[model samples]
Target: MVVQDRRGGGTVAVAMACGTGLAVGLLTSGCSPDGAAADDQEPAGRAAPAAAEVRDSADALVRAGSAAVRTSMETASGGTRVAIRGTGGYDFATSTGRLRVVLPDPAGRPSGGHQPITEILAPGALFMKNRGAGVPADKWVRVATASLADGNLVTGGATDPLAAAELLRGAREVTYQGEEWLDGVRVRHYRGTTDIGAAAAAASPRTAPALAAAGDGFTTGEVPFDAYLDEAGRLRKVRQWFRFANGAPKGASVTSTTELSGFGTKVAVQLPDERDIYAGKIASPTP
Candidate 1:
């Protein structure tokens, strides 16, 4: 009987561990409050593109900066992941967000018929549902962090008005490091960072305190990045290195990708509506 009791306890322990892992995975994978990360993963592909525009020392910073923004905003047909590192150190836990926009075609066909576009964000809320109007598909979309928190961090997912008022602008410079293949295609990589304090401060004074808790102190630090583009001149992959703000990379590579090509082809738009939004659950244990 003693041995049986021990065995039962061990089983229960294992079950608990597995359940906890699943929950953590769901949260860390960038699907916590928003429908951003968990579902709709690109069905893995072969590799990233091999032909991205390389940065030369003589390249103009203005154009380079604009290109960096435009390139980062590039979207794939199935979807693109827009992500950035949060430098404002925080105490509770550092956070980042990945917004997936189901790209709609000019024809405005069924949402499911086109590819999707995805963008990752620093810790905060994303309210594209309201501000997306009249915004060109290629135009860089900016939003505020506070507006993103629909009171229900989980159910409301990620959407808030005024989040886009804060936009990301050109960097001082964009220097290409080299090139490598992700998934399979060859891509050009560049590293850079922009001051988060000013950007966040402009958006809200609480930015500093919130970022401090995340370990990315409110002051300023370089936001490391790796951008990959394919032969067709489309951004294929990007890896950001702000651990708290930008989650750690898989390995040596800052970001990774396995697929490329086509959008608006079998895409679908089924975003959760605002009424379905909420900051916390009815029966909640979240903080």
Candidate 2:
């Protein structure tokens, strides 16, 4: 496995860990409200804005800043499904955050996928556990964000609110879908389509190369997305659909839906026990 940082740092190929069937690429990289109101005169106190005010505001919500979010997504390649669900927080102000990945098996089946993986991010370092198979259980691998190749993090089960929002920033068409309730809040729903290449670039430029490498000749045409936002203009939910015109790398399409809540919440991350961390890299496995 080769680990690089976000900057142009040097790359290092180390033993690849197969914990929970996690791909090497993943190691790296890695909505809204509702409304109502009556017509005719004004209805009592301040009623929520009308349907017209629920227009697409993805860009505003994305650029508004960072917040804590709960994420769940699944990627299908060929006929197998890889599901990753976790709770993490991103601070848009600093463009940094942490996530705890609950790994599942290769087929996302009930058996064989329980390895523990945790990622911590600061300004330049991304510290993670179980970089590869056979590595000491007590050690955390550290990789420089600057040195990582493009798109490496993106394919690595990383879910960032700011990055996800970036995909919506360049939407080709954003239309009001209607109203829906999520987590007990009524939110306005909006749908749109955006160029996958451009959206990936905007979300995280570093992941572009990795995405290309992973998809190689695969075509990711316009990606359709649905977003739900509340009256406060905060994002509540986002659903994305990606399909390849020529054909998906896995012979099927991929869809991921992320739900957000507890805006302006604080996410606390603690480093794992130092006694369990191994500073040396594991050797590459024999062919």
Candidate 3:
């Protein structure tokens, strides 16, 4: 297995450990509510129709064909916090995308500015370049998505754009949180908790395995999320909260946010050949 050396004071390592299926320290946190009022609640106290619409957000993306994506992942542990951000585009029809992820320098360490890592996100596999710590900068590291506990959701530093929307397939207890203006576009906001197991069972065939892996990887089954959808029911923005054990008495918290825009944009991604992938042992990052 190739372990990409992640910078940022061990934050990435801790997050990746949760996906390794290893018995490491655990991190735990409460699922607190975010204050938001429903502009229009369901009639007779029944489930809102918006709930059903939220479940189909992923399908809406597939119809859109492609879009630009921005991702932000923040992990908090032991009084330290680190963030990873990425920008890219995804071709939903082909289930492939590419991102340039920027990693921060380790906290309190001398700054020798780090390079952005290029990541290729495809079905059941993740390819990364500029994987530091002795690996050739030109070589890509390939990791099977099914082999990951978190299904490469948190491990790759940024969650796969389409996978993030597919997660809504299991959305429950959904409440319409009114409409808001985002990036000059009007969007309806919804809040809810999604069951990973349920999502795995309902997700598209190509995405089921990854969600299944995540259902078994994380300590908690319920993931709370806030989603913003356009009038056309396309996913405009989403924020999901996750907790994983990191070998700590009290585990850490991770907040992953993904933003989508420029629907129907052109996204071209090329996969690396087998020979270009690194085959040697990957040196782990120093603590």
Q: Which candidate is the best by lDDT?
A: 3
Best by TM-score: 3
Over the stretch 1-287, how does candidate 3's per-residue lDDT look in tens digits?
22222343333333223222111122424433456535566445534386798899999999999999999876554444456788999999999999998775544222236777899999998888986655699998888887887887788878898899999999998887777999999998888889999999999887899999999777698888999999788999999987766456555567888999999999999999999988887764344
Cα lDDT tens digits, model 2, 193-230, are: 66646555544443333333323322455556777888
Model 1 residue runs over 4 Å out of place are: 1-145, 148-169, 197-221, 243-266, 273-275, 278-287
Query: Which 10 residues in a row give candidate 1 its minimum summed lDDT?
Result: 13-22
Task: Name the lDDT of candidate 3.
Answer: 0.77
Instruction: List residue ranges in candidate 2 displaced over 4 A.
Output: 1-66, 77-82, 106-113, 121-126, 142-154, 197-218, 243-252, 269-287
In model 3, the number of clashes is 10
Q: Which should have the higher lDDT, number 2 or number 3?
A: 3
lDDT of each: 0.27, 0.50, 0.77
Error of 1 at 47 (Å): 26
lDDT of 1 by residue, 134-156 (tens): 33333333333343211111112
Error of 1 at 239 (Å): 1.1
Give the clashing residue pairs of candidate 3, or none.
Answer: 25-246, 25-247, 25-248, 26-245, 26-246, 26-247, 27-245, 27-251, 27-252, 28-251
TM-score, predicted candidate 1 vs. hidden true structure? 0.33
